[model samples]
Target: MKKRRIDIVPLTDQALALLEAIKPYSGHREYVFPADRNPRTHCNSLTTNMALTRMGLEGRLVSHGMRSMASTTLNEHG
Candidate 1:
């Protein structure tokens, strides 16, 4: 996990729909989740964690945990 890698995540219909919904707001940007102060850069890595914390899931889940869960679910189903 230490090594940097590119992952090709398959988009589910729901995910695609969400992306479409956000297109008007972010589609023009280079990064969908661009930095607030600087659109040229990607958002802070802790953004997701911060959001989860705001939603009262700080101890229950972390951003990377979500990715791991998704990967597990996909592999198990496939």
Candidate 2:
């Protein structure tokens, strides 16, 4: 495996905070999500999504989804 370059530096403190919250384990080389606690089964952010869905906000869009939703709006209005 080879190290890959990240194109842009984290622009905001919030962005850095999120990255720090999901620290990667050197062994796995991936972000540590809640579902990854049990290595026997592989799970991603779906666990988080399922939790949110239970709150009646399922499919209401998330942080990443919001970014996608807002980028175009911001670009258009800015």
Candidate 3:
């Protein structure tokens, strides 16, 4: 058996603004970051990892680490 859970992350004004800025590029598509080969599908799961790697953060941090840090910071502030 597995446990399932849902998390609601509140977006900040800046985040909303960024989304609005990106709307023109992706609003017509189903995914905000659509696959390069298939607009109907989302980007690959490793997309964030690849980005981190490109930024020379391969060993220092990963996508989940970024999420965990954000969660921790938000929880601490709230």
Q: What TM-score fits each model?
A: 0.68, 0.36, 0.68
Q: Write one digit per residue (lDDT tens) for candidate 2, span 46-71.
A: 66566677878866756567667789
lDDT of prediction 1: 0.86
Per-residue lDDT value at 48 in model 2: 56
| Candidate lDDT (C-alpha), each | 0.86, 0.62, 0.86
Model 3: weakest 10-residue lDDT segment is 1-10
- lDDT (10s digit) by residue, model 1, range 42-66: 8887999999999999899999999
User: Which residue runs does candidate 2 get wrong by more than 4 Å?
Assistant: 1-14, 21-36, 39-45, 59-67, 73-78
Candidate 3 lDDT at 40 equals 85
Worst 10 residues of 1 by lDDT: 1-10
**lDDT for residue 50 in candidate 3, whole number 0-100:** 93
- Candidate 2, TM-score vs. the true structure? 0.36
For candidate 2, the 10 contiguous residues with the lowest summed lDDT are 26-35
